[model samples]
Structures are given as C-alpha cells and as structure tokens.
Target chain A: MNGLKNDGISEIIDGKRVIVKKPELLAPAGTLEKLKIAVRYGADAVYIGGQEYGLRSNAGNFTFEEMKEGVAFAKEYGAKVYVTTNIFAHNENIDGLEDYLRGVGEAGVTGIIVADPLIIETCRRVAPNVEVHLSTQQSLSNWRAVKYWKDEGLDRVVLARETTGEEMRLMKEKVDIEIETFIHGAMCIAYSGRCVLSNHMTARDSNRGGCCQSCRWDYNLVEMEDGAEVAITQEGDSPFAMSPKDLRLLQSIPGLIELGIDSLKIEGRMKSIHYVATVVGVYRKVIDAYCADPENFTIQDEWLEELEKCANRPAAPAFFAGTPGADEQLFGVHGKKASHDFTGLVVDYDKATQMVTLQQRNFFRPGDTVEFFGPNLDTFNQIIGTVVDEDGNELDAARHPLQIVRFKVERPVSKDDMMRKGL
Target chain B: MNKPELLVTPGSVNEIKKQIEAGADAFLIGEQRYGLRLAGEFNRQQVKEAVALAHEHGKKIYVAVNAIFHNEIANELDDYVAFVKGAGADAIVFGDPAVVMAVRETAPGFPLHWSPETIATNYYTANYWGKRGAVRAVLARELSMDAVIETKEQADVQIEVQVHGMTCMFQSKRPLLGHYFEYMGKSMEIQKRQGTQNMLLHDAERSNKYPIYEDANGTHIMSPNDMCIIDELQDLVEAGIDSFKIDGVLQTEEYRIETTKLYRKAIDLCVDQPDQYEEEKEGMLEAAEALQQEHRPLDSGFFFKETVY
Candidate 1:
C-alpha cells in the first residue's frame, strides 16, 4: 500500500510451506511515461518496443535513451522490462539485428520476445545474456511445442490467445518454463501471427508491426459470379464481420493463478498513458486482492467498470472458457465508444499546497466536477476549486492541449492519476 | 542443381492418375481423418491405393496431417501417424508440433515435411526443424523473393515452395462461418454450388473478394486472387528451391491436370534451357494467362513486393 511493491502469497508445496508464486502482472508501455505509470500502478513487468525491430511501429516506441530510462525506472519500482523484437526479419533487416539486440540487452531488459527463429538464434549468439521468450505470433498451442521450446533454451513462451484455461493447465503440467497469456486486449481474427490480410490488402506487414488492422475493417459479403462482385449483403453500413471484441479476462484471474500461470499479460503497446494507468491499476488491485485471500476472494464489479472507463470495444473472455461462438464475436460493428472521456493526466502532486498538477488532454471547465484516481489510490471527487496555469495565475478553464495546469485538491493525488469530468 | 519437382495435391483417386499423366513428379495426398483439406481427403483403402499408384508411376506421395490439433482431440493423432507410415507414405506433411512429436515417435524414419503454415519464415527456422529430423521445410507464403533466396542458400535441409494455387490468407480452428451465419439469422444448410460449397466474401471498402471455405479443420479465408507463379519457375529454381508445390485440393480435377501440365512445361523449359529464361518468360506468361480462363485471378503475392508495413 505504501508503494508499488506487494507481499507474495504463501502456500504449502510438496508438504512444505512456500510462497504460492503470485503471477506477474504484465502491462504494455508505449512511451516512457506510460512505462512508469504501469510500474507504479501494479504491473510486475512491462513489455515495450524499442526504436526498431519491435512491433507497434506507430506507437511512441522507446529510443535507446528512453529505453534505458524506462528500464531504470521499472527496476527502481521492482518491475521487470521485456523488449519486443517480434518482427519476422527479412534479409534486408539482418544488418541491424545484432546492434538492436545488444542495445536492448545493455539497456537492462530482462527478456526479448521474438517470433522468428533467426532472431532467437541471433539473440542466443550476440546477446546470450538476454532471455528470449517466444512471441504468440508463432501460434504455439500444444504441449510438445512448449516442451520443445523449453528444451531449446527459451526462457518463456507466450501462449497463443486461442489457448483455453483447460489447455493452459495441461501445458503447465508438461513444461518447466514460464507461461504467459494475454488477459486483456484486441483479438486478431486470423491465427496469432500467420495473418496475410493486412499485408496483401494494405501492404503493411503484420509481422513487421505495420498491422493496419484489416481484420477490424467492415466487409460486405459478396457473391463472386464468374470473378465479378455480385450483391452486397448489408445495406448502407460497414458490417465489421472480422472485428473481435477486446479481450477481458478479469473474471478468470483466480483460475489463471490457480492454474499456475506465470504472467498475466495486458496487450496494448500503442495505447495511451491513461490506458496504462487505468488498466494496470485495476488489474494490480485484483491480483493483490486475490493473493491476499485466494479461497474467499471474488472479482469485484468495480474492477470491470474501471477498465471500461478506458476507451475500448465491448469486452469478452475470448477463447478462455472454450472456443468462442457467435456471442463472443463483435460482428457487424466497429467498436463500442467509451462511456467516459479521458480529460487530463496528473504530472505532479504537491502535498504541502494540496495542489495537483496535470497536463490537459481534453477540455475541462473550472467549475466542472472531476474525479481523481491513480494506482494504489482510492477514487475521490474534487471540485475544480482554483485552476491555475504553469505560472500559478488563476484561470477560468484549461483548454489548450498538453497545457500544464494545477488545481487545489482536498486529498493528496499521485502522479499518473487520471482526471475526468464524467463518472 | 537438381530440377525442381512438380508436386500437386490430387483431391480424389480419379485426379491422382490425371495429375500423374499431366507430369506431376510427386503427389501430396491427405486422409479423411486428420488432413487439412476435408474435401480432398482419401479413405484408408484409397490412401493405400493412391500411394501404390504413385509408387508404381515412379513418383513420391506425401500424406498431409497438417491440421492444427487441439488437446481435446490430440490423443487420436498417434494412431493416425502410425497408420500413415504403415500405409507406405513417402512423408508426412504437417504443421503442428504435437503432430511432429507423434510422427517422431510412431514413424521415426518417416520423412517429415514441415508445412509452412507453422510460419517458418527464415532459414534458421528451416534448419532448426531439419536438425530436429524434418526432411523438408515448406516455406511460408509471406516470404519475399529475397528472403526465399536467402533461406534456400542457407538452409541445410530441402525446401519446398508453393508455386501456384489459392493462398490461405487466414486460418482458425474456430467455426467462424457458423458463427457468422447464426449471427445473421441465416440457415447453415445452404445448397452447394456443383456439389462444392465455396463461400465468397469481401471487405466492403476494397474491391477484392476473399474466398472462404470450412471443413473439420475450421475456416480458411483464401486470398482474393489465386497465386500463379508459372513465369517465376526459373527464378524459384535458380534460388535453390528443391520442390515446387501446386495447390489443387480446392480446385477442379481438370484445373489440377491443366495446371500440373502447365507447370511441368515451365519447369522443363527452365531446367533444359537455363539461359533462355527471359526469352521463354513471355511465352510462359501467355500460357499461364490462358490457363486462368474466366474464373481464377492470379498474382505474384508476397513474392515480388515486401508485404507492406
């Protein structure tokens, strides 16, 4: 409760008292600020992308300096950092591969997740100190593969999202290496990393991280009569047939923990700091709550509600219980618009003056009521009592984008706490 | 350099003879129980007959058990692998690691073809499997020419490339079509066209129409245009590609025979007249274009251009 660190759960293993091995809560960090927020909020580790070789090319990926700083910050907060080198490397990409690996290794990363064997081989050769975790793009769903990877010196394997809880338990019994599974995020319509739709359609290589998300695109059912497009199935609407609802496994945390899952991963490297704070914070609390009292614990509705505050499509437990049916898919729809607007992000908090400093992301009026919440802190309402600019001059409203603004608060707010007008 | 062998997938016993007559050097046959292609699957007797016929014609026959297996149904695989080997199959073409392990256990000496659907995109992966006892690596469809050339040069084991056919752009074990139909309040018992149920759909924004089909292996969303690399035969051969595969299970028997014949001519010209590749390229293009007719559209697909961002 004092900071990011939490006590591990105790249990009897092999007839002796031992730590029950609390699963690592993994979160995504698109930027350096997000990285800090993830660690502060509850993430035991954060996965991020470097300047090159990593997927999510469009995300605010870390430069070498940023990665070094991110690593140091995570280390200080007792969180591990894993870099993404999950791209399918081409011959043209061979030259820079070694340098990228070495740089990330030197930046204090715990591991690098990769899909290509060539990258794994190179990581073993050039940066042997850095552990290699197989990416889900490999679509490894069986025990033999996990066993093979464990024998092949891979430190961990991120199970494909298609793996069910029962399958996970079987895999756990078969392999000795760590198993990480995605607990939240967008789902791919195609098999994990084998998708060619994005590449053939948009020319962006999904393997190289230029996923245009062609799967989310609205598609009309067309009858090809002699290679000619015939009738459109739907009228005046983009029927998003391939789009899947964002994955939410909050309800399955206790089961995942009971099954001895090593890491519960949150998939969003291109999302915002607000997203990192909100999602990571909620998961952190849930994991901590479960670890405190596993037998008597149950998932709170507020945890799911807190996650919904972040802009995402309708959430579902995809391929978790079993192979999802029609009810699991988000057919004929884009995305469900977020109920709450992301207003601003707290940059600094001063306890002496009882003033919270923040950068405005959306417009907020001085008289509007706002809710303040962050990692490890309870949600509290605060009226915008005295709005001031960077110079501390009183202002009527904070309208400029990323404008530094401060306001007096009743309770002490911490950095990375989000400010929103609506509940 | 060895002349690249023309391997074709014959859907039925009838097409087996026709494909061989059309000059296919090898055949990829599937079984009704475990093969990825449900329609093209042969029964036990038919599989043995096809293997004997292939052997009698001095051609190789590889059996496909390439469907991704779930743990629920995985216990049935060992018996299947043993049956495939006992049936005198030349090799087992597969994608799943569990199946590979089963093949290793049941048919230790049986030649293994690492079906590229497992995403063997680089030479390291190809060689990794080769070291683990795989005889061939069927290269992934997503690789560019440069990557293919690099893999062929560096790979220690044999490598095969799918030269022509419908490329499966997406594959999942989930029943996407059933879900889609139920969601749309439509009946799943729609009539098949000419006894073949080919489902076609497209992105509303793009003009491309993707062909979709489902079987026991789940749904396969094929590329809008069928891949035609007849003109690229010489290039693929020169890149040290050992075997050339022509996908025919989704196609008609006549289409299979015609395409096999077409690729046979192209492969011979490339092998016999190595220096005349450019000169013969135009004629090959014309012949390949003629084979397209009015139904199948063709493209180089991920071979010529780097798949975009």
Candidate 2:
C-alpha cells in the first residue's frame, strides 16, 4: 500500500497500490506570503487572482510577474495554482482578450477560470490549448447548462454554491466533467455571481468586481407622505434581511467525496496567512484520516474547534442542506472580531535545554495563557513562564514584531504548534 | 382623418370597455393597484381573453412579460411561453434571451417584440434579434432621435419608440433601492397614494427621491413625463418609424383618450398637408405642454436627431 491509500479505490502508480485522495485541500492565496504559508501547511492547491480581472477586487492580488513567481513557487512545492479572470467584458475591452489569454498561457498557469461566454469563446479561439474552467458566476443550475459548457470544451465547472450534494451527484451523473464547489467562504445574497443590485443601486457592478455591497447596509422603512420612519432593521438584528452566514462543510467531507467532487474550494482570497494555513492544515488532516479509514474514521471535536478560530458567522451547511431563507443573515455586527490574536508558529525547537524558541507575532508576558494550535491538535492552552529574548536578556514581554523569543516549557512542543494569545 | 392609436391601461373589463368607448385604439391590461389588480394578470389565458375583448372593439392588445427570471423559474416560464403561443398574443414583449428563445421555439409563428429592458442601443443588436425572430425592438431611452432613425435604417425589425410615459432612470436589471426599502419597513405604496405634488424626501444624501406609499395606496412617484409627439409627426414619418408606443399601461382613461386623439389628428394632417406639417409643429408642442402641466414633465425622446432643448 502506498502513501495515497485511504479509500476503497486504489491505483497502482509505479507498482504500488496508491489510495486515491478524494477531495483536494484547495486554499486561497491573496499574496505570495499566503501562498507559501498555504503550501507549507499542506494545501494540495491554491486559487488566486491577477491584478485586474478577478471577482474579488478588494483582495491584494498579484501582478503578472508576481503571478509567474507565485506559480513557480507552488509548482516547486508540488502544488497546483488556478488563476481567476472572471469578469464580464464590455465590447470596448474585448480588443485585449487574445493578449490576456496568450499572456496567461505563456505564464504556464494550470487553467483560466472564466465567467462570460464571450471570454470562453475568445479563449477557445486565442489559446485553444489552455484549460478553461467555467466560473460559478454563470449560475449553472441545470444539467442543460452544464452540458452546454461541457460540449463547448470546458474542462471543469465550478458548480453553483446554491446546489446540494444530492443535486451535485445528479449533475455528476448527467455529465462526465470535473466539478468544483465552494466548501467554505462568504456567501452572496444574490444568486451566485449574477447580482446587478450593487451596480443598479450604487453604480458599482459586482459582476465587474467593483461591488459597494449596498445590500449589507442597515435600512429603515418610512412612510411616503409624512416620511415617517416605521421600522429599522440594523445589521445583524434583522432576520429577514441580514448577510448570509459563512459556509462550513468540514464535517461533511465523506459525503462530499462520495458525491464525486473533483475539488474542495476554500473561499477567502483576502484572508491572512494564518487563516490559510489553519484551514488548509485542518482539512488536510481530516481528508487524510478519512482516506485512511473511511468506515471507522470520525471527525474529532478539535477539528471543528480549529475551524471556528479562523473567523466564522454561525456556520451553516448552506444550500447543500436546503435553500436558505431570508433570515440566514450571514453578515454579522460591525465590531465583532475573533477574541484571540494569532502571533506565530514555532518554527524550530531546541533539544538541549528542553526550551522552545518562538517566532513571535505579538507581545506575550509570563502567566498569559495562550492556545497552541497545530495541524493535528485541535487547540490546547499553555501558560507562559520564564521568557527571554534571543539575546538571552530576560524580558517581561516580547513587543517587537516578528521578534524571536525563547521560553522554557514543561511539555514537549513540535514545529507545527501555533501560539496565540488572549483566546 | 385617421386617428393615432390610443393605448389605455385598464385594470378591469369595465375600465377596458370605458377606454374603448373613450377612443382607446389598444388596451394594455396590467396589475397595478387600481388598474389590473391580479398578479400574473397577463398570463396565456388572460392574454387570449383580453385580446378577444380588444378585437371585439376593433382594437389591439399587447401583453407585458418583462420581469427578470432566475434559473429555477426557467421551466415554469416554458409553460407560460407555450401558453402565450396558443393564446395568439399580438406580440410577446420580453427582456431575457432565454425567455425570447423559449417563446420563439414554443410559438414560432407568434410575433416577438424586444422590451426596452434589453437595451437595444445600435443597429447591430437590433438586427441581431431581428434575424432571430424578433418582429419589433423597443429603443433604449438614452438613444437620440437621429440615432433611432439610423438604427431604423439598419434594422430589419419594426421600430417602437416610447411617445410618452414615466422613463426608468436606471437600467432595467440593476438593483433598486426599493428592494432595500421594501426589505425595511418603508412602504412604497404610500407615495403612490399621496400623488406626485406631495413631496417625499428619501434621505438627505440620496440624489433622487421617488414617492412611496403605505400598502398599495401610495402613489408611485417614478412616473415619467408624458410624451406628446403631434408636432413631430412629419419628421417621425420621414424617419421611417413603423410604430409609436405610448408608455402608460396604468394611467387615467381621460388622459389616454385625450393624448391618443390629439396624436391621431396630427398623424392625419401630416399626410394631407406635407408642406404645412412643419408649420403645425408649434401647435403640437403646445398640446404636449398642456398635457404635461396636467400630468408630469415630458422629454422629446430619441425622435429628434439631437437632444431637444
């Protein structure tokens, strides 16, 4: 049995029975640093956007040169990279269509993620050899739409997030194409990628990647003649009209794998490296464990606990369970942030003095109990004692950013353990 | 003398008959509070019934199927398309391509007209749909009169220009503050009930404010200015426009009768006194202005080659 063996279906790659990895740990990389962190923490692949065309305009996206570097870096680490160019192009902007496709093709990226039919047709004409993955913005609901794209030479379809596993399974049965879905991320109030509300209301087109998110604002009902204010539904207070809660499917990996999903996409291109690493690491461990023993394996409470640390808004399975009502407001109150601060992880530990050297992010004084979150462990709290700077001077707190400080510990610690304060 | 087509929006059969008697050439039945009060009022069966009644009075009936459809409703729309086809609608107006194709496939013989929401801006788009079974295309509100003439020359489809009505300021599919306001407690119906004279301020920072009402009684303040094109009849005829569309589907019967009668007389005068048509322009403008004072502000639309100042 090879390292890949985990499920019923095993393949012999180079004379070894390899267990096929069901779903890949796809992470979001907004920057090169997050890209590196995602790979180091056991991500199978990463999805990113270039400077201009992706859906997430706010994410600190990479330039052409940076994308090339990022792609090379992911490749070196034996991981794949997907680039987004999913914007609706106007007639004036169609002139540069060929150049952009050819540029990305020459860059040697894995595939071009697209939304518009015009772009798809243009890409087919310009770079026929490049793999084209249909974006979720197309609102691919039925098998007819899926079959239409598949017949048009699309390699994969990012199934609309509004679909359930049963629907996905049905779609997979109908077509012989790869299916990708958002396993985790922020949900849109409008139909997947089809919202013109922002543009209509605020002149900022969400499809064009310039959404002002006027839907998330608070509103009060007023009477016409007197302009008498009637009801006020503040953010997070109104059940019928709140932002959709975030989607979390960590526990449902087995069912998703059974449904034959080609990729498990994580949704957050604008997240921190710690978030990327933590999410990737948790899913990686979960999938590995499931593949090892699908029948006997059970999800630990710790994995769910680790997922909560990465910022969530009352996690729900989303449309996979059933259609979410108007009341499942995903956007929370304005001031809510995770109570804990993630400083940094322990890169290397010294063996001689039984002391652990820390790569610090924020200041921590003795007696401050911080949680140690690692790839396998859920999260375990430990109290700080006998802290010293790298120069061997005793310090009350390590205040400097990225400052390496040493502290004595009673228990053994590994490189994977992440230290966070004020949990 | 030939009378211009009087298009009246009547909610009930009685209202429809009254408008017909009052000189309405066509009856547009839609569900606005006091108008056609039923939801989905212009479905397949209702359209057949409405058309039968309009044909009794030697008038035409056009149905409005211009709402945007999400994915789940596409199949339900297929049934509606089939219904419209069997009912023999004079023209099925639509905005979505999927709906257009469905209507064409279901009823290839039926006339399909492009709704204003489709944003038919140039000759290419107009011709594109014309080739694909669209019998007529409604001009976008932003187009100038000369542009419409140029488009008409290139188009294979019949051109229908809005003569008068409340013009939609935003594009058809864009999100509306109304959705936000409705989700909140504010009633859009209240402003509609109070009439346009009663000022309703939405917010201090809001650039535009339309009246809203409590329940369904408030007056809808988004009404566009009435269009009076009696003076421009000669220019429009010379421009080769096949149809002049009146925008009100839910206005008063008296307003509909008066405007339609005025334009009808003007259309006839253009044929008899071709040279004298230019001299009658002032009288047409005066009539249109008179109607505007009693209703709302009016614009010349894209009938003139340039923006009418």
Least well predicted 10-residue stretch by lDDT in candidate 1 chain B: B188-197
TM-score, every prediction: 0.93, 0.68
Interface RMSD (Å), every candidate? 2.4, 7.9
Model 1: colliding residue pairs: A203-B308, A204-B308, A204-B309, A205-B308, A205-B309, A210-B309
Candidate 2 lDDT over A1-423, as tens digits, reads 012122334455666533474677788899887887788778888888876667788888877787788889888878888888887553334567688777777677788788765677667777877788988765565554566567667999887676767667667776788888888877665454544435434545566577666545533333332434343334454422335567888877777766667889888888877778778888888888876666567889977877777664566777776555433453335324655678766877777787888888776788898877765455667888888888999988878888888887666677857788765
Per-residue lDDT over B1-309 for candidate 2, one digit per residue giving the tens place of the 0 to 100 score: 333344545555555666666556765553322121122244345667777778887887766554433344544656666765666556666554555656655766577777633134556556656765678887765455666777777778887776765444322121223333444445564243332233322332443333222222111223234445666666557767766656553345466656666665566567677767677768876876776533245656434423210
* TM-score for predicted model 1 compared with the true structure: 0.93
Clashes of each: 6, 34
Stretches of candidate 2 off by over 4 Å are: A1-21, A200-202, A223-241, A330-332, A345-360, A372-396, A400-418, B1-40, B49-81, B88-309
